[model samples]
Target chain A: MSQHYRTLTANSSSYFVLVLALTALALFGLAAAHYMESEGHWITGMNNQIVWGLPHVFAISLILSASGALNVASMASLFGKTEYSAWSRFSGLLAISLLMGGLLVLVLDLGRPDRLIVAITHYNFKSIFAWNIFLYTGFIVLVAIYLWFLFERKMNQYVKVAGLFAFGWRFILTAGTGSIFGFIVARQFYHSAMMIPLFIVLSLSLGTSVFILVTQIVGRLSGSFMKQEISFSLLRLLGLLLALEGFLICAFYLTGLYSAARYDVVLFVLINGGIYTFLFWAGQIVIGTVVPLGLIFLAKAQLNSSIRLVSATVSKMIGSFCLLYVMVIAGQSYPQLMFPGKQIRSTFFDGVVVHYAPSWPELALGMGGVAVVGIIILVVTRVLPFLPVEEQRAQSSQ
Target chain B: MSGSSENLGSVDLKRRKFMVTMVASMAGAGFNLVELAMAKTSLEAESKLVRWGLLIDTEKCGVGCNACVSACNTEHNLEDHGRPETDAQWIRKLDLVDEQTSHVHSLPMLCQHCEHPPCVDVCPTGASFRRDDGIVLVDKHTCIGCRYCMIACPYKARSFIHENLTNQRSWSPRGKGVVESCTFCTHRVDTGRIPACVEACHAEGGGAMTFGDMVNPESEISHRLKSEPSRQIREDLKLNTGVRYQNV
Candidate 1:
């Protein structure tokens, strides 16, 4: 019992250190945002052609993460998966945190953050962005209430019903996110009907991986064991989902190439030819998906205890990072207009017809948003009995 | 049966008389307003023909003289910044190349004054709107610095004044943070003067741009369209743009 307490203390210290680092980074970002607002969007690297930059990418990633987290929590609570019940509360808390973080980044990205309320009041029913405002707000509220019921209140049949409602709505909310890009017929790369389903699948994979990583890290710190059955099941689920995601990405590129859409094909070439290609193929694919799957397979095949745990932990982290990177690139790479003859050349950056590199200030604000997520997760874990306290005690005594 | 037939006849007669009176009165009112408005302008055309549009010949547009650009800046009081992309340009010449074939083509680009303008549709405050005469304009008074119009515009004709601009007339509404685009030189059109760009193009030998009332059968723009083949940019979009290009 003393050894377990010591382990918890050490883990808490590390989490605290991480939280502190993220907070400092966020403050720097806030300062940059203030300066940007005082001045204008001109302070950033964005130009006429590349109006959106890194902040937009980060915001989209956060939204994806939030949606994904909600999916995992729903699988346990709404689907009546008793094995996943232990991690449901933590997942719910993370979902709300990521959603809030996503919204913050999105608001900061806007040239006129002061006019945010106007976006809500003035709705274009035809525009997907207008719908997203409502969907995202509703999703956050549902998740918050769901988490509250799990952690603060006694879990009841009503809570399960609410969980089911949240789980169902999140799919539409994520679909709405995809439609924001998918509806633009002008952009050939994003005009496909497959984007909505792709977003949902990616959200599931990313959401599950993040939940797993957070659980493992927290368990390791507190010297509490997550049920081995739940951990293995999640790992296996993630492996299969990732494998499908990888296959779909290949099919997407092949169709783009075969279609011979000149401007649209350029997006693929830019990602594959430049620094982004390495990030895509190496960081996103190999480190994030392939190696992680291999490690999980080895662990399941009765590999050494130390190796299995280390690989599982590494795999989760890499998967989360990969999911984030893919979303960012996808949002940024596609130009505003994708018509073949009607191309507007950008003059903002040199050495290309049109180029986009996120400014330092944008990056800082994005990092700050990431920090906010960490802080929220940390606070929630501390206040609520995120772990099954009774189960832990019984196991320790045995 | 006879009584009912007689009643129906009386009702039909009354309706016909009412319709005639209403049509006559509306036409009278419309004519009076037009006369009153035209009386205020000294250079008003005798025929009351106004709201000029341009027919640009993309093939004949020379890359040499930027006379249209210079005239637009002088008339609009636009800053003489070297970077035309950042600075406002009511009219710009673009050199386009076919990505597959490397075939190059040059065309002078500006606002198309689309029949169904996306910018006007998306404006939350009705800052951007089309006038009755079919010219699209932005009222800077109601603009709230939100660049929704910029994103909605397919032609990318709109520009936002990012910094504080001076030398604007005290009565003039356009300023910083508001969107501005080519108005087809509405002020000059109201006074029966050709737009600065059209006049400049004419000075360089009327081969590039021809301006006149599109509705007038005898107008130069109408004559050019009849005599030569012309095409609108992004015709597939079905925006029904006022601006036409020749020899694309």
Candidate 2:
């Protein structure tokens, strides 16, 4: 069946309000970043030990989600799922915007954001960070080209090849992101090959959830409805991806438990690690994985579709944050075991669990990134024919 | 007999003339023999043959000695920001107690100056680099303050400059939003002086630190390393660190 697409009229006052609100939020985030830069990171929760904190969680999640968001386009073009092609343009747009938001957060959180030009110009081939700089930029370029092919009628034939390339690049991009943690030989929490797959599956799960929520909101705004068949299929896909994410998380912990060297940290995170432990069991496993899975499968016959969708997506998003909090923050919270059999004490808080309480500025900066993504999606859908319109509506309008 | 005596006298006169010529040339060049040797040694500091290293006898390191730490601060002019957790600690004293035995040992920890330094390997900008003379240093000009090097260091040897720095010593240039660590007092080392921490340790602390060329067999560091039992903190990483420790 041929798919129809439509753009929002954008004349509504609510549209302007949303635009204004998102712009304000984005500005607030920028202001927060400026405050941190001027006042220094000491004002934030991060210390010398806990170098990466809340902003990293937001940035990494968004970046990981960006790659996952592209799965729709990849499915339609690369996997020959023609039904998914209708939503591919929207998917591509979301992917780029999400990446932009993530990259912005990562850059701003840097000690010297002004030297971004140096990061671009200078290349340390050995460094995974340097590699990611290329991977991230190349992803945007490739996705843009893919979107171009999807938008232009004459170039539609080459969309498949572009989709294939984008799919491969996203995989590599996620791996590069994962390797940023995995390559660190110093820390016990990371430095595993498992990070690559874990992050890849997480992106798939989180990105799909974002896609569903945003599409639903866009549908309400545009007065377009998705066919029940398509909605159910996406839900099933989400359930499957969530299961994969859950499985990987279990495997990651089990592997860590198996290693005597990593056992202490694993125990710390799982049992005694106060916030980290609670987040792992309650936030990540139950809310992120278990509840979402239950809502999709167990409650399918009993609950309303909108309730189920909202509940599962929201749970997944919350769970993702919790997991990242544990991964990024808790990972560093456990001190590096520099001396194997010796307990160390120093003025620098060595051999001690470093506690980090993220300040307001950190939260603002993170939320700013989220708002930027929101604004990008809202504006693009209004200006461009991104929202998928129903066949009947398409016929009636024309 | 008269001719033979005359020949002997000529030979003696020739020998005296040669000795005088040598002394006159040395004086003309304005360099005493000792000063010439010192200049050659100074030039060799830039060469890879001179691997600067430190050997710390943890046994001799006093438990409460803050001399080395204070000296490093004074040397670098690391301002007291009132936040010790976020301050730059180029070198700090570590008190280690064996988990099984509960025997306590004290020693100072700083940048290990590894042969295959992970910080240099992971640095995106090549700002965290190891000099030819086996000293690892962060180039202030190129360091974009990513702090990946800090994360990569196993010893937790690095610190990020948390706030905007002022009143920094001209020799030790520090700024905000950049990573800094123990430079092994490269400024002093360049001018034929040991690191302030080593000097202070010798003068006020336990005299535990011995600084010398690791490559030179005749150097005290090389001799101690050979004669005494010294080991790197994380020898399993095979980083070949320039810093070595004795006892527990």
Cα shift from native, residue B117, model 1 (Å): 4.7
Error of 1 at A7 (Å): 17
By TM-score, who's the top model here? 2
TM-score of predicted chain B versus true chain B for each candidate: 0.75, 0.83
C-alpha RMSD in Å of predicted model 2 compared with the true structure = 9.8
lDDT of 2 by residue, A120-181 (tens): 88888999999999999999999999999988989989999999999999999999999999
Q: Write the per-residue lDDT of candidate 1 for residues B128-157, one digit (tens) a residue.
A: 787655678887665654565665666667
lDDT of 1 by residue, A107-172 (tens): 876655676766666655655666788899999888878877775555655678779879888899
TM-score of each: 0.78, 0.92
Assess the local accuracy of residue B104 in candidate 2 as a C-alpha lDDT between 0 and 100: 90
**Candidate 1, DockQ score (0 to 1):** 0.08
Error of 2 at B187 (Å): 0.4
